[model samples]
Target: MNLMETIHLHKNDFSKTERKVYDYIVQNPTAIETATITKIAELCQVSTSGILRFCQVLGYKGYKDFRFDMLHYLHQEHVEVNSENLFDELTSKYLSVIRQFNNIDQNKLNQLIKQIKNTKNIYVIGVHYSSLPAKHLVLGLQDLGINTYFAYDYMQASHLYNTIHEDDLLIYFSIEGNQNNVSRFFDLTNASKNTYMITLNPKPKLLIENTLILPGYTLSKQSIVDLQSIVVIFVELLLNMFHNTLKED
Candidate 1:
């Protein structure tokens, strides 16, 4: 279930302080994407420990866990796919996008592959539909015995920033490339050089240096296109390529 549903089910059992946290969260859902626990506590006029108790009351380990789930819930609020007889249209779009995949910047992809091969740890990040590719990459990396962590984004006090080394890699999977959120993510790493972004946006803003632009159709409001499916195919093929290249002798 989504975060709001979980909150609703447990709201009645919340303490007075917890209700304050909930009210602020519902009023500013997107702010939680990058808000720290301390910031939230101040905004809700509650103690930091109060926020922790609120998260625990909602069955989360803590505020970090709650924020991650909250971001997932926010991203879920999008237009659903329609099952119309636009098979021909969708097929044509898919073909067009697939052909564009052939034009992927090999130089950048090679650099990305090298980074993945050399890094001891990898953090795969994405929000909304882009999470599909992030998750696919995470599982594929694990099959190759690589250490991978899948997260919507970095959180305060999360290990993503604390244990990240210079040799580590941070690969972002974003469909449109959220500039502000992604820029902050990069800043959190102290402007790490071992960063890469795989995105469909032709002109993504605040993109990392190693970004590789891939072919994709942006899902528009009420559109009958399934662009994410094409990205999945591309990521799967990319993973297969990685498997072939990085597997042990």
Candidate 2:
């Protein structure tokens, strides 16, 4: 089990001091990535020994080992599985997903922007409900004067993928991330080809190396609507950020 899972499974067994430390760790996982044991102890209002015992209880050798595992856990995307407020849940979900982007490596985003600017051509692809957001992104990119192509179906996308070259880029969107055509496209493209996948699923089936897993509400049939509602905002951010960066250059 991961650190979060371990915490959840055994939190009730914790002593008062340990519970304080565990709660702080759960709420501020990102902070722990750079935090010293002394600093964490201060934040949790506990002694350093208390923190060490907490780590031991969680099956780690020491605080450093626990901190390392927590840092690694933060790398994987997470999604909320429950919501109490139905009326505002869509907005809440989008806000949570967008917050995840704050932790994204700025260098990685800059590299993608540079690749997009340097590409010979750009193609956007998505399957089923994912196509809606993909189309929205293509239109926004086109509005910014980027030459963008989009393929809405498997046959059309296969034909377009054939023409893709080294300098070309493919930006794919998928809520589920396991579309048959998407898998095929990955097979056809060279490892050197520029590709980015923006997925709404936390535990996507595709599991490609180049993927951004965004959190989204997937509780029921209306979940697709939830995704569509907020993806445009993200697409707008990407297009405008690229446009502004180009002008600065």
Candidate 3:
């Protein structure tokens, strides 16, 4: 259920401080995305604990979880097509994603690639829309003669753990990084040696063991089309870098 429904169902049960948080969120749903817990508390004249309690009452983990859910909710609600030069806007947005990728930490990329090169088994998994990119990446790795596998479903993906070893790697692809199923899967297979994630979420909901995070688009301007292209490009560069390192050695 969405936060609105949850709030409505439990509105009467809210404490005085929680009431303030509920009222503020109802009045300014858009503002909550970027607002810190402290800012929200100050605005409502309540403590941080109040905000936490409010989120908990609404069935969220904490303020951060509430923020992530609210951000996605607001985005879905506010999807608008700008009639002013559609082509130009799309082009600009796509370029912006690439520019964001260019600024990624080279050291982190190098380290991640090094892990990929040495890993005997590479398992790629993504949920919903993220699967498109995950498929592309797995195919590219296979072309390079890597033993890559893409998980089509949670059950099929879980089978990998039976043969999982210390030199194996799991690359998780997520757009928002808030899938409950994905988190559960990660927990069930926590014994994996290296867990890497490529995600647009700045703050992931789940933290897997030995996880290497590669952060992607910060803004939500790009559509799925743009996102797929950006992801493919990122993986292409990773493959090139891996090849270059091998050639140099």
TM-score of each: 0.58, 0.64, 0.60
The lDDT of model 1 is 0.70
Instruction: Judge candidate 3 at residue 40 and give its lDDT.
Output: 75
What would the per-residue lDDT of candidate 2 be over residues 1-249, giving only the tens digit for each residue?
A: 676888889989899999999888776665564457887797789999999999999888999898777766766535554666554755654455454454444565677788778887999987677778889888888887889999878778878877777778888777666645565554533335378877755556665567665434333224535366545566777777798888898
Alpha carbon deviation, residue 165, candidate 1 (Å): 1.4
Note the Cα lDDT for every prediction shown. 0.70, 0.70, 0.69
Model 3 C-alpha lDDT per residue in residues 94-133, reported as the tens digit of each score: 5544544534556667777888888888888876677887
lDDT of 1 by residue, 128-199 (tens): 677777888889889888999887644631446556677788887777765776555446334477878777
Q: What is the C-alpha RMSD of each candidate to the true structure, in Å?
A: 17.7, 6.9, 10.2
lDDT for model 3 comes to: 0.69
Question: Given candidate 1, what's the lDDT at residue 85?
Answer: 44
Q: Lowest summed lDDT over 10 consecutive residues: which window, candidate 2?
A: 215-224
Which segments of model 1 are wrong by more than 4 Å? Answer: 1-85, 153-159, 183-190, 218-226, 247-249
Task: Give the RMSD in angstroms, all C-alphas superposed, for model 3.
Answer: 10.2
